[model samples]
Target chain A: MASLIFQIVVDSLLLGGVYTLMAVGLSLAFGVTRIINFAHGDIVMYGAYAAFFAFVSLNIDPLLSLLFVAILGAIGGYLLFKLTLDRILDAPGINQVLLTFGLGLVLQNVAVILWTGDERSTTPSYAFDSWFLSDDIVVAKGRLIAFGLAVAFVVLLLAWLRWSELGRATRAVSQNRAAASLMGINVRAMYALSFGLSSSFGTATGAIMSFLLPITPFMGFPILVKAFAIIILGGLDSIVGTVIGAFLLATAETTIAYVVPQGIGWAEGVAFFLLVIVLIVRPTGILGTVGRDA
Target chain B: MNLSRTSVMVALSVFAAVISPAPSRAEDTIKIGAPLSLSGKFVSYGAAAKRGVEMAVDIYGGKVGNKKIEILFRDTQSDPQVAVNSFTQLLSEEKVNFLIGPIATPMAMAGLPAWRRTRALWVVPGATTPLLEEEAGKEPMLFHTFPYGYYYHLALARSLREKLGPGKTVAIIYSDDAYGREHLPYAQKYFTQEGFKIVAEELVRAGATDLNPVLAKIRRVKPDLLLGLVQTTDGIQLTKQVYVQRLNIPYLVGTAYPQLKQWQDASGEAQEGWVGVTTYIPGLKAKADPKYPKLFMDSDVWKAEFTKRYNREPEFIDVGAYVSTCMLLIAIENAGAVDDKEKVAEELKKLDVHTMIGRGHFEPSLGGTLNQAFADVVVHQRVKGADAILYPKEFETADKFEQATYAK
Candidate 1:
């Protein structure tokens, strides 16, 4: 019984790692640009396919292909912002939402046309390999690797935000756009950089996920919903809150799934349910400060 | 005044000529309307059905008797309303006397009213809901080539009883939509009657990616067999997760497992010994029958051509589409006239023909419904990266069912 509980906890933590990776970028985009970036998951889809093609056509290893995918994602995100978001920066909230939603539809349709609706997956040699801690407890190699990378990326990003010039400028713009503009920070450039960096995070997450999950043009919408739920639960602009929200959501889902009879169907609803509860109890989220820019 | 009168006379004469009946040509073509879900969630099946119909047309030399077959295709978008609208348009606007497909069960069900209203000879290729067959009882024009979902489960249940003996416990994990919801009860009914204990039954949302929660629950129960009445995506996901999480059950079986390439790509090496119930088994070496060798050879040639054209192995939906279309052509030929709808329906009722999948005949024993085609349901197991028939003693190509092992 103890072993079973331990297994569930380990599984939840691993799942939390994936959710953190998927949500952090979404949180960052919303934090800096306030665009919501509805197509963030589609960008992940593009990254996954890019990594897929690289592996299949170019015979590049998936890990090495992450670099190429991240670069592509950064460029694509920058161009997308310039083409779509730049024009509507000062538009109403509804307009921003609609624009991003429309862009997501376009990206999804284009992916379908290019790749067809067939589900694709990549299986490296160690995809299914695991390390056994005991007779009943095991750690999957793919999840462990993905978790390590996600943490590394998050730490690096936080460090950059603290120390790097561009990152600090981005934070300043996110905190107070008018003051940052008056203070000689390139607000537009910061917006573009934040969007690009956020997108690269999403793409890198997809590259890691490609080793674990099946890839399809339609796969993004579900993940997108979960990412939104996580950001909302964690606070829209708090990075630490987003990470906490991910683990909380994962734990709730896994635990509820374990307790209820035939509860798998309800497991997916746990995230949204948490979102509602979080909103009702604390509108500012766990770590959020009231009246902040984001 | 005389010139004006002459011009008026000429204009009146031209008007009269335009209003007159046109002369009939030497040969008239038969227009078959196909309302397919060619561009939505069901697009893969829709595309396969389209290819199948086209291939069947090619095989028939694009004609039946003295009439050249002309197919007018409409996309249903996997929407039932779209299916009905397309069917209505095909009947009223295109003036087609025959029809094929809507690809999915809900679309097929929704299009049934159109079938009754139009009374066009409708041959459904892919939808397998038994409810459609029940609803089809009132319409003589409606027919389905694919066996109902319940039939597949019943066959699997019988095979399980015979091959593995009785009293085994089974757990079912199915999608929570029309296809899975409707079939789950039937599976439970049949499996229970065959002496298998119903340990657990679970439903998951369609297109769900996270199945670990459900897998964990099932692992605790430790049923003898896991019956997955899920979509291709869900089935692949379940199998992969089952292997990765080491959820040990004696057997894991479901639909769409015969799609070897898809299963391999999705599940990797975990696909070995994965069993699936299917009507069409690609590359199955059949017993010698004087009438079937040519048909078998032709099917092989068609498969090769299909692979060459599509750059992928043909799915059972593709074969169902092809067979349904071929049956329609044969009925048209047997009717002796392209425009004779009543004669064509009569001919379809009398159809007892062999095609790519197997011998297809509408048995009258099934509630006197002459629309349901009876075909052999073979149990196929993934053996060494390819699916091999393993049940019904007669169709057993592999000597025995090998036990599946996962990495420890």
Candidate 2:
């Protein structure tokens, strides 16, 4: 029983790391622009496809190609923001939501047309390798790598936000757009940069997931739902809160799955249940401020 | 006065022309409605079915005795509501006398009310779940060409028991979807009947990323065999995860996925020694119907023809669709190129020919479906990137069952 509990803890932590990667980008984008990029998961799907093509066609490992994919994703995200989200920044929230939602649907359908609904994966050696902690405990190397990358991503993101000139400017814009504009910071440029950085994180996460999950055109929406739940639970604009929310949801799901009979089947509902509880207790979320301070 | 007389003469001529039949421009034809999921989650199945149907028509020369066969293709979008609209459009508005396709079980179930309204001679090439059978199996017009889920378990339990001996223990990991929940009871009933003790039954969420928790639990019990009841996507995940975890179970069984090239390709080296049940594989030896040699040629020749046209190898759904469409066309032709569906159904019932995926014949299924075809499932294993047939004795390719390579 003790060993099983240990395994569950280890599994939940790893799962939490994966979940964090899924949501932190959404958190970042919402932190600055306050408009949800519904196509965030589709961007991740495209990254997975990009990594997959590099692996299959050019024999590039996803680990190696992730850097290039992230760069490309940043440029794409910048262009996307300039084209669509930038125009709707001042529009009604529902209009922004519909625009992003429609954009997501378009991307998904285009993927289906380009690549038929076939399931694929990148088969790096690590993807199929594992380490045995004991007779009863086994850790999958693919998931461990994902967990490691998640930690590195968060650390780098937080560091940039704390120290970098561009990052500080973006944070100032997120905190008070009107004040930041008055202080000579280009508020729109900062929003664009933040959104681009968020996209980079999303694509990087996709590269990690290319091995861990089945790659399909339709693989995005379910992920997007989970990410949305995490940001809402953690605090929509709080990076740290997003991380906490991801871990909390993962822990609840993993514990329930391990302890309850046929619990894995019920894990999909955990996010909603957790959201309800969080909303009841703190409407703004665990660490969320109601106003514009991210 | 002369201009008015000319205008009256022209008006009378136009009226005569309008009243007369316009040289048969509508044309004599047979209309068939195909509600397939051409663009959504079930796109692969729908695309393959589309190919098979097209090939059957092309090979059959696109006509049956002077009537051009017209197929009205409707995309179900892989949504139940869309499928309902598709059936309504085809059955009610277009009023097609023949219907086919919508491969997934949920899509088929959603089309039931619309189907019941028209009662057209519907030929279904897929829908492995028994839900369709339980709903419309007794309908005289409903012809199911794919084997139900029970056939998979029936063949699997019998074959595995014989190979591993009667007392070997089994563990089942089923998905939480309709596919998994529906197949679980049958898996239990058959495996228990075969004298294998079921040690564990785990339920997994469909499309889940990590299957480690379930795998870890499964490892503790350490059964001899692990049976995964999942569709192609989940099957790929389970297969890869099981291989990664190296559970060391002597046998790993899957339902309806191991034979899929997409699954096999995605699974990579992890596919070795996994047993699965299917109605057709590429190498199965079958002769064409002696009467319709051009349409129902031998299996290998037909496969080569399909590859030449589609530029890819065909999956089970592709083959099943082709065979089903061919049989329906033949029945239509045999019914003397008429619009009488009752006659075509009767002719379909009378069909008994040697063709691919077993005899082109219809009989009652074990699950109480009145007209089921391709119920004989071929139990096969993946060894060194090739399939080795194991069931039905006559089509056996390998003498003995092989354990998973990593396990060995």
Output the number of the DockQ-best candidate. 2
The sequence of per-residue lDDT tens digits that candidate 1 reaches over residues A203-273 is 88788777677788877887798898888888888788899988898888877776677666787787578
Model 1 TM-score (2 dp): 0.90
Cα lDDT of model 2 overall? 0.90
Tens digit of per-residue lDDT, candidate 2, span B35-98: 9999999999999999999899888889988888888899999999999999999999988888
Q: How close is candidate 2 to the true structure, as a TM-score?
A: 0.96
For candidate 1, the per-residue lDDT at A39 reads: 90
- Residue pairs clashing in model 2 are none
The true-versus-predicted C-alpha distance at residue A11 of model 1, in Å, is: 2.0
The CAPRI quality class of candidate 2 comes to medium
Interface DockQ per candidate = 0.44, 0.77
**Clashes (N, CA, C under 3 Å) per candidate:** 0, 0
